[model samples]
Target: MAYNFKNGRESVGDEPRSGRPVEARTDNNVQRVRTFEHQDRRITVRMLAYELNLKRETVRKILTDNLSMKKLYAKMVPSS
Candidate 1:
């Protein structure tokens, strides 16, 4: 003998979705700078971002603020 509710409702437990999408970083330049520092190699921002799996803005920030690459570039420019 099987027992059933008067409404014949089926019990379904709440389950988490397994197909959720992962968030992707939008800035690639920032990631590029990070990759260069990590790998200790010179590479284009585009390539660095691709390899580092980060946003470009992140790489750009690192190069400008943390690495001081922008300062280096400024010093390289001859005084006019």
Candidate 2:
């Protein structure tokens, strides 16, 4: 057989990518989150997650890290 299973397999292809970031954390996703926040300046992280179909933590990361935004006094605003 071309690909042996007894001892070892013969396969030559691209290396597996286990350290790559998930699609949810890509730049495109960040931009999408930015757009949503722009529409509603007071949107909460939990609300954003629900609207964008992402996890609360992921949305928080996108908002704080990628977008440079923060929640202050129940408002999503740009952090200086």
Candidate 3:
């Protein structure tokens, strides 16, 4: 069985996301974020975001999730 919409708006592939797009998260960006954090533990999220041209949340995710780190007393350190 197949169901299709005759409207011109219909597309054959997945639609774009609802947000600003997923450019912030990438292998290169992740490595860059790690390098920046390693160079300065006290680097602020705002600074990282600005340097990488990514949103604060995206930078934070790279730090916490990708790097397994967390903010501790205004510093980024290992989660464990």
State every prediction's TM-score relative to the real structure.
0.39, 0.68, 0.71
Instruction: Please give the lDDT score for candidate 2.
Output: 0.82
lDDT of each: 0.50, 0.82, 0.83
Q: Choose 1 or 2, whichever is better by lDDT.
A: 2
Q: For each of the candidates, give the backbone clash count.
A: 13, 0, 0
lDDT of 3 by residue, 3-75 (tens): 5554454667866679766567899989999888778877898999998888899998888888888788887
Give one digit per residue, the lDDT tens place, for model 1 in 18-72.
Answer: 7733444334544545555656444655565566766666555556555556534
> Positional deviation of 6 in candidate 1, in angstroms?
45
Worst lDDT run of 10 residues, candidate 2, spans: 1-10
Off by over 4 Å in 1: 1-41, 71-80
lDDT of 2 at 49: 92
Can you list the residue pairs that collide in candidate 2? none
Q: Give the Å shift of residue 36 in candidate 3.
A: 0.9
